[model samples]
Target: MSPYSHDFETLEDSLFAMNIMILISMALPLLNVLGYFLR
Candidate 1:
């Protein structure tokens, strides 16, 4: 069995990936806030 045969992925590549995910998760709220303020 080769290591590549059962490859698993992780979200521990870089702090940037974590930060980006956080940013993405918050995008909806941020947009909602903007819409609320604009309205």
Candidate 2:
């Protein structure tokens, strides 16, 4: 019923996607370092 609800939903989706990408980017390097140390 709110006028701005649709825009807010889209913004939240984009923010969620950005967070996922950032987490994957951070995790990849951490995994590489762990693999090196474990090997």
Q: Write the per-residue lDDT of candidate 2 for residues 1-39, one digit (tens) a residue.
A: 686998899999999999999999999999999999999
TM-scores, each model vs. reference: 0.41, 0.82
* Candidate 2 residue pairs in clash (backbone atoms < 3 Å): none
Tens digits of per-residue lDDT for model 1, 1-39: 666544533334556688998998889899999999999
* Alpha-carbon runs more than 4 Å astray in model 1: 1-22
Model 1 residue 31 CA deviation in Å: 0.4
Candidate that would win on lDDT: 2
